[model samples]
Structures are given as structure tokens and as C-alpha cells.
Target: MSARHFLSLMDCTFQELQSLIRRGIELKDLRNRGVVFEPLKNRVLGMLFEKASTRTRLSFEAGMIQLGGQAIFLSPRDTQLGRGEPIGDAAIVMSRMLDGMMIRTFAHSTLTTFAAHSRVPVINGLSDDLHPCQLLADMQTFVEQRGSIAGKTVAWIGDGNNVCNSYIEAAVQFDFQLRVACPEGFEPNPVFVERAAGRLSIVRDPREAVAGAHLVSTDVWTSMGQEQEADQRLALFHPYQVTRALLDQAAPEVLFMHCLPAHRGEEISLDLLDDPRAVAWDQAENRLHVQKALLEFLIDPAYQHA
Candidate 1:
């Protein structure tokens, strides 16, 4: 049987995604209560990255250990896939040894190509086009604190980068309305907008987008591989930052979120993370929980061997 791949939110049915989010909350509660659940014992996850990571690596590795599974982290220097090997060939070889694989890379095609030739499930850790894994955690955090996101309005401020693109997908999969406020030249991929049908909106003014929003999110003004355009982007995105004042325009119970490694005084106010409405820390921690749910779901029928 062909393995399921999570290259995007569209890969799963809406019901499956919701189940994962709820299961994530249950897993988090179990962990907090000191209950041990290791459904993936002896399973192995191979994580390959062409990009630098802190949260992604830590969360996946720690979650694996906690599940009684093991994860192997491979950097560009540690794998033949980095030194000009074809992604398909690497995936074919790696999938034979690993139960599943997660890849964080530059080109979205790298993930598609890899998954095409692999027997195990291939997950998109981060790609040039989307960051679905992060969205799982973000949605989990929102659901835990504010209940279901269905029919709610979510505002996306600043650069319409990978994380923003994932939000676009999440809006459709999770059944929420999304308003993306970005600079003129920074709009998200048009194909994604088309996929959202009427569920997503793009605007130039952050305030206009955040008006009466239930959830607000933003990412770095400049993402990895875009350092060359940082100054220009900074100038264009300055007015797009998510500030306490800007979020105040949202609903009274609005929740603010950033996919972290936030730039203080840049895409967000330095104190925005400290505000009571900002759930960045909880959002970050949920990465571990949700990803554990994801790992278990994709590699289903996990064993519980010591």
C-alpha cells in the first residue's frame, strides 16, 4: 500500500485534521498528568534538513523520545542527499531503513520528489511553499484556548511567507475565514488564494484585516534565503507589523500568534509576545504535542514495545 504523505494540509480530510488537533490536546494533558503513552516504540523517524532549525528539530526529536521511538537528525553535511544526490534516490534508500521521514528544505519539489519514491510517509517539515507542521501546532493551541476555529476570522499580518501560506491552507482545512494583510509585492501564491475560494482575503492594511478578527498571526519580515532583500522588505513591511494597538482592533478575546523566532521591534512589537493575548509560547510548545499526534497518525498502528 502507498503510504500517506503530509506535504500540505490538503493531503488530509478536514475530519482527520480535527481529530489530530483534539488528539494533540489529549496527549498534552496525558503528558502533564504524568501518564506514559508510547505507541511508537521502536519506530524510527528520519529528519533531513537543508535549512537551519531550532523548534522543529527539538520538538520532533523530543516527541519521538517521549513516544519510545527514536529520531535521527541529518543536516546537509551529514547526508548524500545534500551533496548533489537526487532526492528520489535518497528517499528510496532512506525509506527502506526508516519508518517515516520529515524534510525541511528550500524547494517544495524536493519534498514531492522524495515522497514520490518513498515507501514511508513523507512529512513537510518546512518548505519554500508551506509549513503545514507549524500550522498543526498553531491550530491545536488555538483550539485548546479558544475552542473550535471554525467560522472564526483569522488575520494574517506582515510577509505572506511559508507560514502565512500554511495559514491559507489551514483556513480552508480548518474551516475558518482568513484575512491576509501584507505589503504590495508580498502577497501569497495566487494558486493558494484560488484554492481558498472565498475563505481567504488579501489586503494591504493590517488594521483593516484585523478588524474584529478572532485570531491574528504573522511571521518574519524576511525568511531564510531572503536576506539579500531584508532592507527593502523591512522598508515595505514596517507598517505591517502586528502591534498591541493593531490587535486591539480585533475582537475582545482575540488571540495573537507568531510562529516564533520572532524579530522584536520588526514584524511585531518587542512587547507583543508578553501581552496576555499573545500565545506564542504555548503555540511553540504545542508543536511537540501536535507533531506527536501527527507522527502517530501517519505511522498508524504503532507498537508499544519497550
Candidate 2:
């Protein structure tokens, strides 16, 4: 209870993080059984998006409504954040009006700046550097399909973007192992890598990284703003594609995963993504359940029946 902000996976402790996941599972099961609950009554979540998204927008709004709370969408064009106003000032103001703030923006520092000034909880819907909410769904999916995350190995192949960053952070907390395969110049942040020195292992070969891993994860070769460099990236990242041959190096129970809106033949092959062991769809659906649990936790700290 009383979580002031959710800027990154590292923002939460290991136990708190697991609590949210377990609570998410319970909420999901309840919803499937036709149970309804108003856990966040009279709460309003302000969702600010400087970047475009389909899943982020829909999951958060729907999650809020499902919990008996309301969500207000704020696009870049609709807010003064676009015109020139500082996020600090906006954060101070919005914190007074809304119960929580969910921001999907460019820089991680922007959300940090907002959290610094805001009194209410701020969730990192997404950022150029980390996507904690997405990983919440990911962790839930891991637990649901694999039963537990501790001691499991996860392999990441492709551009080391926000999702990969959060995955590393999740591994740091959950006692899991992670191996990443990215092009020479496209490696993850050096600071993050250093922070994970003892906990994580890095590799250059996609196949080598995926070897014996329980879950294989990947994202697009080119992220949203990197469209201009898509051609070059594709050429350079071809070796990192999650193909059937690559998946063969993983454990027999290895589950394939990718954040939605995949490029089919680019970062991952269609056959691999559609494989029976692929848990991409379950990962996407978990987004809603995790957010619902998060909302309930943030709104009522005293309500601890998880």
C-alpha cells in the first residue's frame, strides 16, 4: 500500500513484486469466474502518452474500469507538456488532482522527474529506457506457464531496448538467470550492465545465449523512433533472429515470447512465434490482470489480503 511511483522494476522490492504477481493471478482467476469487485472506487488514473501505443492504452484504461476506477487519457498534443511546460510543474499539479499517474514517454528521466515532484503514485507505462508494466505481465506469464521464475533462465535476442532493460531488472530481483544477444554496437546500457555484474551473464551469439534457457524473449530489431535506421538494423541484426534453428538450442520446455506488434519475418520467424509453446498471447492478456492488482495495491495499502 501507498506506493508513490512505479518507475522501474528495481523500484519495487523482491517480495513486493511477487505479491503483485500473485495478486494478479488471483484477480485474473476471479474475473474468469464472473466475480466483480470495486477495489479502486473514487480513484482516477491519469495516463500520459508522449509515445504511441495500442496495448498500453487499452490495457491500462480497461484495467482501471475493471477495478471501478476511471482513467483520463492525455496525448502529447492535448497537454501543455507538448507546448513547453515542464514535467515537474505538471507532475505537482496532476498529483493533486489524480490518484495515480501512468506515463508512457521518451526519456526515463522524465518519469523520474515527475515522480520526484508528485505526491501520488506514478507508474512507468513505458519509456525509452524501461518498460516495467510490460514486464509485470511478462513475470505473470512466466509464473503461470512455468510455475515459478526462480532459477529459470531467460534469453533475450535482438535490440537491447526498454523491454530488455526491464527484463534484466526483473532477473536481478527474481533469482533467475538472463543471457542477452545484441549486435556489437547495439548493446544495452553500460550502467545497467554494471549494476547487474554479479547477477547477469551477457553473450554475443544469439544461439549461445539461448542455449538451455527456459524462456526465449525478443523484441523488434527497430523500435518506434528508430524507423529511419530499420534497414541497417535489419542487416546487422539478422544473426539475432529467433528462428526455429535458434529455438532448438533452448530447453525442450522453452517458451517463445515477444511483445506484440511483431514484424513476422524480422526479429522472429512466424513459425516460431506461432509454435504451441509460444506464450505471447498469454503474456499480452496478463497485462490487464497485473495492472488491476497494481491499482488495488496502490489505492489501498491497508487492503492486504493478497
Candidate 3:
């Protein structure tokens, strides 16, 4: 049988995605209760990072250890991939010795190329086009805090970057209504917009998007490798900031989330992280639990029956 890769949320059925979220919640509970569950015992994961990260690195590494598995962290300096090695060659060589591989990189094509040659499952930790793993955790956090997000209204305010693209994908898979507010030139990919036609809408005004929204999310105005464009992005994305007043336009119990390492006063209000409406902390922590469940779904034999 061919290995199941998790390069995008589109890779799984809607039922499978929901199951993973539920299982993530259960895993979190088990961990809190002092339960020891190590389904991936003896397995190894190879993590390749072409981009720098904090939460992505720590969550996957820690989750692997908790599952009685080991994870190898490979930076550009640590691998030949940085020294002009083809992704397919690296995938073939690494997959031979690893149970699975997770890559955080720039081009989306790199992941597709790697997965095509990989014998084991290849997970996209992050790519220039999508961040499916983070969506897993975001969904888990929402479910844990506000119940099923099936029919809720989610407002996305900021640059239509990778995370925004994944949220566009998430809206289709998770059955939510998404209202995106971004600058004219910063809108999400037209392909994703057309794919999510009825389920999503794009607007210029943040107030309009947040009005009656159940949950709100945003990411840094400028992501890694885009530092050179920071000043320009700041001026362009200024109107899309998620402030308390903007969030107030949403439902009374509306929640706010950010895929952290946030630029406090930039994409979001400086006080937003500590506000009662912001669940960024829990959302950040869920990265571990959801990823652990993701690892099991892609690796554990028992998960076939689950």
C-alpha cells in the first residue's frame, strides 16, 4: 500500500479530520491524567527545516518523545539539501531510515516532489502555500473551547499568507463560514478562493468581516523570507489589524487566535494576547496534542481501525 501523506488538510476526508481533532482532545486529556500512551514506540521521524521556527520545532519534537519515538532535527547546515542536494534525493535517502518525514520549507513544490519519492509518509509542517498542521491545532483549540465549529462564522483578518490559505482550505473541510478581510493586493490565492466560493468571502473592511463572527484569526503581516517587504506590508496591512474594538464587532463570546511569535501591535493589538477573548496560548499548546494525533494517524497500525 502507498504511504499516506499529510501535505494538506485536503489529503484527509472530513470524517478523518474531525476524528483527528477528537483524538487530539482525548490525547490531551490522557496526558493530563498521567497516562502513558506510546503507540509510535521505536519509530523515528526526520524533521527538515529550511525555514526557522519555534512552536513548530518544539511541538513536533516534544510530541514525538512523549509517544516513545525519536525525532531528528535537520537544519540547512546539518544536511546536504542546503548544499544543493535535490529534494527527491534527500527524500529517498531519509525515508529509507525514518518512519516518517516532516518538512518546514518555502516552496510547496518541494513537499510534493519529496512525497512522490518518499517510501514513508511525508508531512508538511509548513510551506509557502499552506500550514495544514497548524490548522489541525487551531481546529482542536476551537473545539475544546467553543464546541463544534461546523456552523460557526470565522473571521480572518490580515495578510492572505500561508496560514490564511490553510484556513481557506479549512473552511471547505470543516464546514464553516469564513469572512476574510485583507488588503487588495494581499488577498489569498484565487484558486483557493474559487474552491471555497460560497463558504468564504473577501472584504476590505475588517469591521465588516468581524461583525457577528464567532472566531477571529490572524498571522504576522510579514512571514519568514519576507522581511525585506516588512515596511511595505506594514503600511498595506495596517487597516486589517485585529484590535479589541474590531473583535468587539463580532459575537459577544467571540474568540481570537494567532499562530504565535506574534507581532503584538502590528497584526493584532498589543493587549490582544492577554485579553479574555484571545485563546492564542491554548491554541499554541494544542499544536503538540494535534500533531501527536496526526503522527499516530499516519503511522500507528491501530489507527487503521480507528
Candidate 4:
């Protein structure tokens, strides 16, 4: 059988995703209780990064260690893939040594090409087209704070970039309603829009999108490799920032989330995270938990829930 890959949120069944969210919480509890559980003992995960990351890098590396496994970090300069080696060729060789791999790259096609030939599972850490891993953490955080996200209204306020695209997928997979507030020129991919099947609505006004929403989220106005477009994006995205006043337009019980490494005054207000409603820190910490469950599911046959 071919290996399963997580290039996007749609890659997994709804039930599996739900299981992961629950299992992640369980893992977090296990860690908190000082219980040592290492189902993936002696296993190894290869992390290939073409982009720099703080949370993604630390979470995956530390999670593997905590799970009684090991993770090897490979920078673009440290790998043959960055030296013009074909992704398929690199993946074929790497998968022989590693139990699974995660790639954080600029192009989504890079993952597709690598996973096509990889014998081990390939996960998307982040791609220019989608960031499924972050969504897993976000969903897990929401479930921990509020119950099931199904049937809830989610407001996405900011650039309609990769994270927004993942939110669109999450809306369909988790059965939530999503309203995206972004500029006209920065809309998410049309293919994702088509896949949403009406789970999403696009609007230009941030307040309009957050109206009565249960969860409000945003990301940086500019992502890695987009520094050239910073000023222009700042000008276009200024109106979409998630402030206390803007979130007030949502339901009184609404929660806020950001993927982390967020710009203070760009995608959100400077003190937005200080509010009890902002769950950004929890979202960041949950990345480790959710990914630990994912690694167990993909690699350890002993994980009964997988």
C-alpha cells in the first residue's frame, strides 16, 4: 500500500481529524501528569525546511524527543534537494532512513512530487498554497476552549493566504461556517473555493465577516518570501486587522486565534493577545500535542486510535 500524505486538510477523513483533536488533548494531559509515553520509540522523522520557522521547528523536534523518537532537521543548504536534486530522488533515499517526513516549502507542488515517490508518510508543515499542520493545532485549540467546531461560525480576518485556505478546508472537513474578510486582489485559491462547496463566504469588510461569529482568526499580513510586497500588503490589509472592537461584533463567547509569530499591529492589535478571548498561545502549544498524535497515528501501529 502507498503511504498516506497530509498535503492539505482534505487529505484525512473527518472522523480521523476528530480523533486527532481528542487524542491530542489526551497526549497533553499525559505530558502534564509527568507520564512518559513513547509509542514511537526508535522511530525517526525527517524535517526538511526551505523556510525558517520558530513554532513548527521547535514543536516537531521536541515532540519527537518526548515520544521516545528522534527528528533530524535539514536546512535547504544541508540537503541535496536544495542543491538542485530532484524531490522524488531525494524523497526516495530519505524515506528509506526516516519513518516519516515533513516539508515546509514555498511551492505546494514540491510536496506532491516528493510524496509521489516517498515510501514513508509525508506531511505538509507549511506550503505557499496550504498550511494543514497549523490548522490541526488551531482546531485542537478551539475544541479545548469551546466544544465541537461543527455548526459554528468562524471569521477569518486578514490576507487570504495559505492559512486562510486551510481554514476553508477546515470549514468543510469540520463542518463549520467560514466568512473571510480580505482585499479583492488577495483572495484565496479558486480551487479551494470550489472545494468548499459553499461552506465559505468572501467579504471585503472585516466587521461584516465577524458578525455573530463564534471564532475569529487572522495571520500575518505578509508571509515568508513576501517581504517585497510588505508595504503594499500593509496598505491593503490595514482594514482587516483583528482588534477588540472588531471581535466585539462577533458573539459574546467568541474566541480569537492566530497561528503565531504574528505581527502585533498588522494582522491584530498590539494587545489583542492579552485578552482572555485570544487563544494564540494555546494554539501554539497545541501544535506539539496534535502533531504528536499525528506522528503516532502515521508511524506507530500500537496507537490504537490510529
lDDT of 3 at 19: 91
In candidate 1, what are the lDDT values of residues 1-306, reduced to their tens digit?
899899999998888888888888989999999999988889999999899999999999999888889999997797776588888888899999999999999999999999999999999999999999999999999988989999999999988889988999999898899999987878998889889979998999889999999999999988999999999998999999889999899999999999989999999998999999999999999999999999989875652211
| CA lDDT of every candidate | 0.92, 0.87, 0.93, 0.92
lDDT of each residue in 27-56, candidate 3, tens digit only: 999999999999999999999998998999
Could you tell me the lDDT of residue 103 within candidate 3? 95
Candidate 4 local lDDT, 12-79, one digit each (tens): 99999999998999999999999999988999999999999999999999999999999999987987
Ranking by lDDT: 3, 4, 1, 2
> How much RMSD separates candidate 4 from the native structure?
0.9
For every candidate, C-alpha RMSD to the true structure in Å: 2.2, 1.5, 0.9, 0.9
Q: Candidate 1 regions off by >4 Å?
A: 302-306
Every model's TM-score = 0.97, 0.96, 0.98, 0.98
The reply for model 3, stretches above 4 Å from the true place, is none
lDDT for position 221 in model 3: 92
Candidate 2: the clashing residue pairs are 1-301, 4-121
Better of 2 and 4 by lDDT: 4
Clashes of 3: 0
lDDT of 2 by residue, 236-262 (tens): 998888888888899999888888888
